[model samples]
Target chain A: MKKISKASLSKSFWRWWYGNLTCFTHEHMQTFGYMWSMLPIIQELYPTKEEQAEKLRTYYPFFNTEPQIGCIVVGITAGLEEARANGAEGIDDEMINGIRAGLMGPLAGIGDSLIVGTYIPVLLGIALGLSEGGSVLGPIFYIIVWNITSIWFQKFIYDKGYELGGNAVEMIVGEQAMAFRESIIVLGRIIVGAMAGSWVSINTSVILTYGLDPETGDKIPVFLQEKLDGAFPGVLTMVFVLLCWWLMSKKKVSPVKVMLLMVILAFVGVLIGFFDPGLSY
Target chain B: MSISWLQAGLLGFMSVLAASTPAALGTTVGNYTLNRPLVASLFVGLILGDVPGAITIAIPMQIIYIALVTPGGTVAADLRAVSYIGIPLAYVTCVSQGLDLAGAEAQGIAGALGALVGTVGTVMFYGTAMMNLFWQHYGWARLDKGDFNVLTKVEVFLPIVTHIVISFIPVTILVYYGAGAVENFKSALPMEAWYMKALFTLGSLLPAVGIAILLKSVINKTTDLIYFVGGFALAKSLGLSLLAATAIGGMFAFVNFQIAMASYKGASSGADDEEDI
Candidate 1:
């Protein structure tokens, strides 16, 4: 066999072994290929192919190529530290792919729930403003909030995962995700409850309007507000929570049916004036 | 013969459609499943001229997907949003829907329709593609060896072909229908004479239900529940903004994570020690 030069070996390796020749389905080419492709690029910069490859292996699942973010950059930092300690040998491509593959899924799940799920909704809703001024800030607010939160988490998690690779999940699950979930669920429960309360309070108030007092035309103090308060503070919200519980938990209603029913209801409500936030038909 | 750019492009997108269907998940037919929306958007962007539009569409599509949990033979979250929003948005924004078709309401409508059928088409195409198992078995029988590459080729062909074909039908039908139905809805008069306030009041409850669904996964323990109540109470008394409350809650979660992780680790290690002994 011909001896492979470092420069020529790199080129030949990429073209021959890595020509995007997806061993897996080409559909996942973007994901899988992206993680593997970084090896030659990194190796070219440093002679430590085996070393860098080992670092990158812990995060393969994050190998999305569309906008091209998230790879073994952090892991390489970890592996480099390993090399420095040992006066070490290099890393390989396979090990990098392995590391990347492992961390990407769980991190994506956490990131998806936090940044995309809870934060975006609450932030966007608040940003929508209290009036009809058509503020352009709504979209802008969400965009900025989302990007900042996402970027911070992505970078933070990658480093956190790599630096503590042996105990990354434990560190994350304990220090971050657990806390993240705690905050999320707690606030989520309350907002959900308040929304429910607001729904009922806004909807079912019994009016006790009496004609202005006969002589002075002054409204007499009646216990109407008190009566309404005593009767029901959060009837609709209660009904809503129970309904969701019943559908999703007890009766085990399917989500699709619920979505379909809600969609139909929303359209009907829009037509009938039942859904407006400030006013009603 | 070398494949021309347009032809190659057309083939690429068509392959995406075939591969992206839900039914494709079960079949060894095609490998077009790249987390649907992002992949679809990329396809449309490259085909047309607006990668930004596709990305914009992908965000909501992702949110909508959060509610989509398919456990044990079920469907959740309509994966059709890409076609519904992406296609129309692409056409409206001209993801090669044609410059002459610029702002063509029909193109927008078509894209929406394409998304709808494209989604369904993904299912049907993959279901048919499942026949590939038999094809593979037959090839193995004949040659004593088989190529997994057949699945790859079929996968590539399906989505790209499906997208192109499905897209045209919707665009055509939407154009044929004109905006007559939507126009009629727009012109239809509201019943201005009724108890409008009451009706609107009831409508406000809609969001509460959505929130309930979203909040389902948030509460794990009783302590978290207490914090939620505390945050809400603070918001009410001190008039703290909801955003402020959420941030506060997040801080509580951080503390909770530390406690929970330590406890879990201690328990696990104890169990391991017990096993060892």
Candidate 2:
């Protein structure tokens, strides 16, 4: 019984890193990359060509997960393959593939919330500040910080997954992971809200003139935006965002339709002398 | 001064290369960040010898798509084409029109142009993803033959080549021809036209769509909507920066998380065999 070498582990890790580079479609998502990543392990564990081919075929199922955090699944499978090669009992193809398939959902949920929802927004917030002043560090900071953190964290989870094997799934879906995911989800929601307020620009500049000024005998051009802001700043932006959300989420209207709706609204608003580009807050 | 035909062609070629880099490099050398309009503008600036101006133009566009996150293969917009193909064309149009690089008008023009380019990019994105399906079929055919050695090509090289082929023509033609077309259209068409004014007006509002798409993805719970409205109130009332608001939100989430965790522990007993492991 031969154990997998360090060199083969590195090759597998590299293959896993490029998992979503190609052939990603609605059908069999990440299947080809999963199969590719396991090639080195399959080759090392099974000496015979028939055995290698059979083992490799097991990874061809519809395997999709957040590729960065999903490396844990790949790493755990590597450990299981090593164990099975040493003639371990109770580990079959279904068990291995089942674990892979199972972990995909939870890990994807956590990874998407943490990485996409929280981290990227926070980083972009910082980057936007830096870039507004015409600083080159904006892009540079984003590249360096994002790559280093993601790469280091991914490697840590991959090694941990290998060590834990089947038990990793239990640990992942356990109380601690749930707490962590929920906390981040809360944080992410807050940040996204903050972002929406700051970033989503919508304002109206239409002025209502009813009465004349007593002193100057002039028409008092009452700006509607000032009154709206007096009530709640970014009120129009919030309303627009909610409208778009309702259109997409509740009404099942496509994003294209929503976008077209905005365009038409903008056209009518501008033609009626209500909304202007300079009116954005 | 407007760019020459040769410069436009060269920039077009570079744009395609830059646009495909994120997919081609595949996270090895920080290509994900390079996929951004800010970075794309940097490279375009370097090539065009106008770094500051390009970066200035790209900053606002970058802000519009700052929250973009494409999870589960569902993309809202493709910023790659906007960055590589659109920014360069916008810059060229600015130069041709003698627009001030520092002015709001310049930024608005570039942003509006980017929004238009990004709409087209959604098509290119689906087209590329759809084309890759053919390659997946090719891999399945090879896999069925029991030849596992070709899997490397299926993962890396084939996809890179497929992306380059799919992205090159549109990027080249759009950047090269689109720049001149914009200039021609601008000279003939009056900016005071109601439709033209409306188009710029619409561009200013397009960022709302980007933000809304993000909100749709992240807002799952009913109670979670409070944090969103709360954050908005905080920003509007206090004039808070995003970082400051996020920090305050983080503190609230920590307390909320502790309570939730405690309840979760109380609800489930230790002897329960729910984990199936």
Candidate 3:
């Protein structure tokens, strides 16, 4: 191969248009299945050349490859396949790693959410419901979702990864990506807020102090309750929110660790009468 | 081992995720790619004799996949845990048992652990795989960086074998046994198992917190809160189904996209005005 000068190397890989995303998916979803998810490139990898080119040029100045890490793997995978088919030479680690850098992000989104976000929850839900586990469906739902998505996407994406990758960027901002991005961003906000609201509305009980009807002989922690009432009106959920915020901001704990800690806390609370159902700990 | 079919499936998916890093070095050319939630779900179905459930979860996942990405050295999705942990959960909830994964309790612990494991596992796997690739590509390996030559062959091939096996074995076994362990655990529980059930029930609540955490960095503004709250409130006050919630969320996401795109265009226009100036 002739040595191409770094300067001559175009930031925009205009050639990536013809490549197939399935190639990356097959190797990634079928074989290995690790870091990257489909989020980075799913919407990004379009059906046409112009779209692919448009994606590239957008990220061209920043040196950000369109497919990011996961899709980059798609590129390098195609490169290796090309080399192998030609019988000229084999692939190398650097280029492969380069692909890794690009594809990891795309893969991570799907990976984290599906496995962590959706699958793990499904699995744990089963485990939580049943003693050792729930019914057989617990594991089954999770297993099926993961494999089907992984395999299907890989096969589907690879066949068109490069073809899609090659020039979608040139297509510029289109209706599809625009619509998609808008939806996700909005959905993300709503989901986050609702979840946050749940956190603020779980268990809210205030201890009574001085303010109350003397004849009724009922004391009210009206102050605290009043304060909470302005918000979600639940003490437990509020505490959960505070705890999450604190751990996340002040303690600098990882969310996973926090989750684990919460489980432990819940377990201990269950035994210690802290998670009392009537009172809503 | 004689693991049950579903357990075996979970194990299989887990193994796939665990092993992806090392395996990808040789197989996928060191991209360390993973998107395993569907894999585990499918394997569980195969084990339990039900592919339909797998398809259901996988398809939704695919459509929503527009949100995924893995950008340069950073993890976009974190598949390792998703597959190892996520698929098994689906199998447990969807196949063997009849609980919906959306609101299952056990998923809380299982989900967090699965994700945590995948992320951490990827870190170590990447480090090891990267180092091995380095040694093979350089050092005594005498591998040529020159792309497609003779000496580079041996150096290139050796690390992948080791890589693939390293990742594949442990996770597979973990997933394999994990599901069965949960099953066996249910049979042995006393009346107290109900309490365990309650705790697990609480586990369902964990995901919302997780959602909060997941969106923490992703959502950093009040308007974002409005968008989220709008959809969330619709579902909650109206008691809408998750599917409906997802739909509303999708619509809001579309609005968000429009606003963001407009801003991006504004920035571009500003650039043009600067050029004119």
Give the higher-lDDT candidate: 1 or 2.
2
fnat, candidate 3?
Answer: 0.19
Candidate 1 residue-wise lDDT, B106-165, digit = tens: 222333233233345335333433433343334224322323233334333333333444
Best-first order by TM-score: 2, 3, 1
Interface RMSD per candidate (angstroms): 10.1, 3.1, 9.7
Docking class of 2: medium
What are the per-residue Cα lDDT tens digits for candidate 1 across A221-275?
5534445445554434455545654566445576545544545654465556444
lDDT of 3 by residue, A189-266 (tens): 555444444322343223445677779878745645456555633434535644664576456676556656766776
Two-way lDDT contest, 1 vs 3, winner: 3
Task: Identify the leading candidate in terms of DockQ.
Answer: 2
What's the distance in Å from true for residue A223, model 2? Answer: 1.9
Which ten residues in a row are the worst by lDDT in model 1 chain A?
A64-73
lDDT assessment of candidate 2: 0.74
Residue B241 lDDT in model 2?
Answer: 92
| Estimated TM-score for each candidate | 0.49, 0.92, 0.50
Off by over 4 Å in 2: A210-214, A278-281, B4-22, B27-31, B268-277
